[model samples]
Target: MADITIRLYIGPSSSDLRELVVPAERPLGDLIIDWKKVYLLAEQDSQGEMIRYQLYRESEGKKVPVDPKKSLRDLRFQAYQELFLTDACHPWWQGTTSQPTTTSQSKAPGTAPLRGPATSKRVTTATTPNPSPSSRPLPSFSPCSIELAPGCVRQIGETGVVINRDYLLRELPKSVSTLERTLMWMRQESRLLAVSRSDNGHCSIVWKQSWYLMAHHPVYISGTKYSRNEAIQIEETVTLLLGRDGWPITIRLHSTSITR
Candidate 1:
C-alpha cells in the first residue's frame, strides 16, 4: 500500500498546523523522535535528562493525548487530523518546582541525592507566580505553550474553542463596553461554553486557579439525544471521549459524518 498523508498540528506551548506523508504502519514513537530531531533537541538535554514528547488531540473541548507506541493507522487518525505535541517531563503550563527541593547540607526525608555530574550543572529556572488563596504557585514558563486565537463558537464549531487565558487577558478590550459588545457578538453565534477538565478529572480551567465547575447544566451538543448505554446509530457526527482511565483523553469522531 502507498504511504498515507495526514495533516498535523504540532506545538508545545504554541502550535502550527502542517501536512505530512508517511508510511501508514509507522509507529507514532518514531514520528515523535523525528520531530525532536527537526527541532534539534538531543536525546537528553544539557542536564542529562531525557526529553520526552506527549501527543494530544483536541476532542470535545479537551486535549486528548495520543499513545506513541501505536501505529498511525491503528490509532484511526484520519487525514488532516490535528495533533498537539508537548514535552512530557517539562510541560510549560506546569511549574519548575517539579525538581527536587534539596540542599548541600542534607536531603529531605525519603529523598535521594542527585546523581552524577548532572547534579553539578545549574538549569534554567522558570519564574513562578505567587500562590493564590486556593492554588499553589503556578510556573511562569512551560516547555510547551498553547497557541490561542480569538474566534466565536460559530467559527470553531460545537466542540468549543481552546484559547490561551493569558493571551486573552492581554488582548482583551480595554473598555467594558467593547468587551461586552464583543461578547455579545460571540453570544449571537452560540451560548453554553464547553468547560475544560484537568488530567486529574477535576472540572477546572487550565492555568487558572479561581475557576471551577460551579454548576453544570446539561445542554445537548446537538439537537439530538445520546446515551452511553446505546450505540450511536445516527449518521450525524459524534465525538466520543474514551480511555483506560476514563478521563476522556482520546477522541473518536467520524470525519465524513459532517457531510452525510
Candidate 2:
C-alpha cells in the first residue's frame, strides 16, 4: 500500500502553532502519542494521560474522528485538513461534539476521568515602562561582574529561600529585549511547563529543563544587590539570564530584614 500522509496541528487555537506529517495508516492514538513526544507534552500519571483531538476534512466545516482501526485512505480526508491535538488538560474545543444533557446523567458529576492537572492560574505581572527614545545606551559590561541583589526571599521546604526580582535597569544591556523574545520562544517550545509555587513559598515559571524564580520582596542592592523598586527590571533581567544560560540559578536571602 502507498504510504498515507497525515498532518497534525499542536497548540492553542490562537497561537504557538506547530505541524507534523505522519504515515496515514498510523492509528489515531499512536499519532497522538508521537505528537506528545515531539512536543514534550507527554507527562506521565498513574493513569495514562488523555489527549483530546479534533480532525476535520480540508476546507470543510465538519469534523470527524480519525479512528485507529480505519485507514486514513478510507476516511477520504483531503490534502490538508485542520488537525488539533493537546494534552488532556488543554482539550481541543470540540464545537462539533455534543454534550449530554443533565436529564441523561448516566455518569456522576466530577466522576468523569481527568486527563491531567487543571489549567494553571494566569499571572499578570505589571510590565516595566520602555525607556525614552532619547535615552543613551549604556556601555557594555560583563554579566558576571554585575552582582544581582537578593530579591524577595521566601523559604522553600527547609533549606532554601528563593529570590524573585533582580533586574537592574541602569546596568542592563541594550539587547535585553531580545531576551524577552527568547522567553516567549522557550514558552512555546516547551508547552508542558507552567507557573507554580514551590512548597516553601517561592513562585516560579517552570518548564522541563528549568524554573524562573520570582522574588517574594523586591531586592535592593548595587554592586551587591540590584534595586528592588524596579520590579519589572528585576524580573526581565532574571528571565533573560535563565533563558539564555539554559541552567538554573538559586536566588538566596541571607537575612529576614529584606523588604517585601
Candidate 3:
C-alpha cells in the first residue's frame, strides 16, 4: 500500500496547541485510540470505563460531526488542512486543543501588547505551578501540538543544523527569513526539542510522559547522506501509535531530499 501521513492540529482557539501525525489510510476510528495515549485526555466515566470520542469536520467555520466508520481516504484533505475531533463533555475552553494563526503577531502600533489567555487567568499553582524562577512554560509551547514544515539548514554557533528539507521547500514562505532565523536560534538554544538519531538508528523523543517516534529522510550534506524515507516512516509509526490514543497527528514536510 502507498504510505501517506496526515498532519493533525489540536488544542484551543485561545491557547494550548499540539500536533499529531497519522496514517492517511487508517480507519477513522483509530484517531481516538491515538489521542488518549499521547495527550492523556481519556478520563474514566462514571462507571470507571474509558470514554469514546468522535471526529468532526470543521467546514465553512462550522463543526460537522462525522461517522467513525469512514476512511480518511474518503476525506481527501489537502496538505496542512485543519480537522478536529471531540472528546467527552469538558469545559469549552478546556476542550479546545488547537488553533491556527498567522505567523505574524496581531498587535497595534504604539501600545502595550494584549496578554494571552494563560496570563489573564488568576495564577493557580494547581494549573500553573512555577517550574523555576527563570523557566516557566510559555503559552506557545504546547507539547501536544507541533508546527510541521520543511526543515531548513541553519548555522548554530559553528555547527550547521538541518531540518526536514521538503518541509522548508513546500510549506515555508520564501519571505519569512526572519522567522527562519528565529527557529534556528530556538534550536541552537535547545529551546526547540530535537529528534536526533538514536543508537538504534531510529529518531524519537519522549513527549507528554510517553515515547513518540520520528524518522528522517536521507539527505546528503557535504558528501554525507541522511535518510528521508526513514524519517517519513518514523512519522507514520508515530501516527498509528497516537491514533490508538484518540488523537490526530499532524505531519509537515521537514525535508525534500530523499537522497542528499
What is the per-residue lDDT of model 3 for residues 135-164, given as tens digits with 9 covering 90 to 100? Answer: 733222112223332343222211112333
For candidate 2, lDDT tens digit of each residue in 163-246?
A: 222322222343542464466567754211221223422233221111123333222222122121111112122322322222
For model 3, what is the C-alpha lDDT against the true structure? 0.36
Top-scoring candidate (lDDT): 1
Q: What is the C-alpha lDDT of each candidate?
A: 0.38, 0.34, 0.36
Candidate 1 colliding pairs, count: 8
Poorest lDDT segment (10 consecutive residues) of candidate 2: 226-235
TM-scores for all candidates?
A: 0.34, 0.30, 0.33
The 10 consecutive residues of candidate 3 with the worst lDDT sum are: 239-248
**Which candidate model has the greater lDDT, 1 or 2?**
1
Error of 2 at 139 (Å): 63
Cα TM-score of candidate 1: 0.34
Can you write out model 1's per-residue Cα lDDT over 1-260, one digit (the tens) per residue?
Answer: 45777765442222234567877787676676566545543333334434456667668856677777687788877776666565554343233223211122222222211112323432323353333334743323211111222221122232222332222334444463255346656785211123123222211122111111111212122232222221121122323222211112111223321221
